[model samples]
Target: MKKPLIFVYFFLLISPVFAQMEFGFDDKDAFSPHSIRQVRRADVMYNNTVWVRMDLREKQNEPFFAANSEITKIIIDAVKAGVLRPYKNDSLITRMSIQEFNDNIKIPGADEGLTDEDLAMGFGDSDFGGGDDWGGGDWGSEGGAEEDAGPDEFFPNNIYILELKEHRMFDRKRSRMYYDIQSIKLIIPGELYPTGINKELATFSYKELVSNVFVDNPAAVWYNAKNTAENKNLADAFELRQFTGKIVKYSNPKDNVIDDIYKGNLKLGLAKSQEYEHRLLEYESDLWSN
Candidate 1:
């Protein structure tokens, strides 16, 4: 069971966003398809560790925009040149406090007894990367779907928020410059249980099974990516900010023996999730269509 969960978590952290985004360029200018802007993501091993940087032009950055020369590339290039580094490794990001976690992370039937202290403590000890994992414990089991929606839980799971300040475009020849700060939230899937009883059950044998059996629910606790533009007017002059993320392949998050969730190692895990998500969406659509 732990093996599968570990694999699934990897896929969730690395998979790219395939949905097409609309840049709202008159609804007819297909040239301005949604361009990915930020590419940073949280780490599964380190609580505050960021896996990637926001600039779109890095050895790690990939295509984020539908068009050829989107700002994502520009940002990436800047990162390579030391012009921009929106996210860093050593920096400490301010997140929600314990009270905020309860107010925001609680699921529909989540045990009220569970507190933020419990979560923080769990995170501190859960072998984030040093090979000292408390496998088969509550950290991987409790807090189901609700964990996926909230920022505190999800961001730590590999999703990240990359903000760009004072972004502007100028008609250099015309001597006019417009500036605004931009924020992008990117959802990077991490080690999470998808929606399926068999998948969850497979993680642990009957002997390893405990009171809280993980269900193979995709929404159980995953991350997502997004992009927001503060200055809408700049869309015409420059471009709407974007977010892009990627997943790498590694043996483990634990330094000793645990493997890190990376690409290519979790194909089947993702396929199962896709099938499950498809059925669920179909079922919901049918139910609502009536």
Candidate 2:
């Protein structure tokens, strides 16, 4: 009787080990209310992190694809309210009517090689230039930036500005009512760029590469700090539908950069919005679970 009782005791202690082995225990699979592992993320950003492009030039009928238009309107409102900034990329090309083009071309300078209007049509300037830093930090004294400004003056130089770099809406046929996000770039603040050794001009750091919707997408190289309801973060602001735009190609070409072979599939474009919503739900579910 004593030996049987001892054997039963050993069996009870050893059974769980075998069960754990069978199930294959891992940090992600195991959970405890008392302890939680914070997900590690990169501090600095780099180019090609998580960029998305939306094109809203397509015209859709009522209720079918109207979310595209509605989403864009919300984004435009955020921009106007100073909640989000639109990047005036010089690369953007706006379509002009034939009569409008002709009317504008009737300038004082007739021929003489090429007119300013013609050149303007070929290439235009966007407001995303590195003019006075977006955040209102006073300029350094007359001597020089280094001579007048202290390290404190330079460390937290300007408020980081968010901009949608590639915004384009061509006057094409209103076949599919939609807007397009030609490309999304996460431009870093100018003050953060590394100043040349000779002080000639500051250059963007490797971590400051342009590309990625740093606000909405958190898994990328940018989402590091935590945010509360009192103070909102980029991801929080974006979750409020602060970005509105059209989709050019539903299948982003940059998807090729990842091991996700199915992401850039052209076939998936037809059901993209649905697929995206599903993903969002899954992401939200993951927040509390695991």
Candidate 3:
């Protein structure tokens, strides 16, 4: 009697599956369209590549070590100590800091040997161009010309401001010419989360797994190139202003402006950079969309 009961239980268990197959409920044609394999957006999954353009003239110069360029010895030391990592490809590398980046960066008062006169603005070789960075002007004068600038204008005061897209703006209200970061291709790392059953079981696996598993796979650079024999990384590339950035790849390589193809393209600057990066990345992602 127990054997007969066991047989009945087995028959009941397999009957529905057999019935479903015979009735074509599990037919290949009945599969949802959503179940069909779809192509993946590699960038969405692996956000390891970046093309960045830093404007060294946009942000305020660090009062400590960076004046003309942010790539100073202190920053370089930090890179060497693994507080920072510069990348050229997938490899997080330590390249020799170019001598000019180390020696030529003009920190206001960091160097003991630099004389006040040496740092002072003298009318010496206006042989190239005459005047302060803004234009010919008295350095400490209270007023120059009080004119309201358009939304995109550099400065309201100072009758003459460099209007070139590449020029740095003078914030006359603050009496300061804040520095800008230059452009580069930086491969910033992605966020890490726990995997498998550990997601609920472990409290600290994500951070620990990332630190250990990706110790060799840290954020790095992508397409920053060094045509010169002098080895340089993303930091060095931006310090030297090595890259010319644009919203989209120029259809014509000879065209100096990226606006040729991307009509009405906004000029590049340090401000609104995150907005620009996001919108551009979206443009790239849209190509993969149905």
Candidate 4:
């Protein structure tokens, strides 16, 4: 009886191990809370470390097919470098022809033999030469011109500004302090390329890059620090892009006026009212106009 009890106890302990190895134990199958399975991803890289990425599905098959092309990769690389001159296919052809235009006309510096109209077409302007409404007005400074200014100066610099549309706040309490994120348009400057390319042919807008809807409950951590610890300290601490909560207008937790709208300061109320009015006008004209 003692021998039988001993054998039964050994079997109970080892049976699960054998079953797991041979029959397989999947979380989906076993309905286990803590089971993990290998997930197949769209892209995989394992050079110094493993990296996996999932491809976003496009609404249309044409876009989906286009997304996976060499041209797309070339365009994406150009975009990442911030050197990509945005142009329509026809405009791009004309701009590239600039080199040819100069060469054909025997102009020493010409990239393409193109007319003034051709150059103007590429630059999205009706006329050629300077004073082409290069966006710099009496109020704003022109692009590419050397100007001594601080980092935050409005002068067109290497980085382009995307003017965000004023967002509306319907809820009276929320409106007083917080405003919703509205449309963001890319403010591409004229001086990006001195050679001048088609400005109307905007490469891609900021809104196009980032969707209108915010991602809900995205996986915060790429790699788990606890999992690294479990791996006998062989793994390094995971580097994560810490996302401070969504952009909120009134984030001050200590301020009582920020929360209480009725007793809120008059100045802030007046400012908010002005902002809300401006936003309402934009909504009516830019967003809701047929």
Best by TM-score: 2
By lDDT rank, best first, the candidates go 2, 3, 4, 1
lDDT accuracy of residue 285 in candidate 2: 50
lDDT tens string, model 4, 65-129? Answer: 12222122322322222333332221112222222211221212342455678665552221112
TM-score quality measure for candidate 2: 0.23
Could you tell me the TM-score of candidate 3? 0.22
Per-residue lDDT of candidate 1, residues 1-290 (tens digit): 69999988886766443212211224233211121221111111111111212433332222233232233222222222222223221121332232332332223234444578866665322121222221112232222212122322322322222222222222222233322222332222223325321110001111111112212321121111133322122132224223333212112356221112333345654454355436544644554464
True-vs-predicted CA distance for residue 197, candidate 2, Å? 39
Off by over 4 Å in 3: 1-51, 54-75, 80-98, 108-252, 255-287
Cα-based lDDT for every prediction: 0.27, 0.29, 0.28, 0.28
Q: Which stretches of candidate 4 lie over 4 Å from their true place?
A: 1-159, 173-176, 192-290
Q: Residue 78 CA error for candidate 4 (Å)?
A: 10
Top candidate, metric lDDT: 2
Question: Between candidates 1 and 3, which one is better according to TM-score?
Answer: 3
Question: What's the C-alpha lDDT at position 184 in model 4?
Answer: 27
How well does each candidate superpose onto the true structure, as a TM-score? 0.19, 0.23, 0.22, 0.20
- Poorest 10 consecutive residues of model 1 by lDDT? 199-208
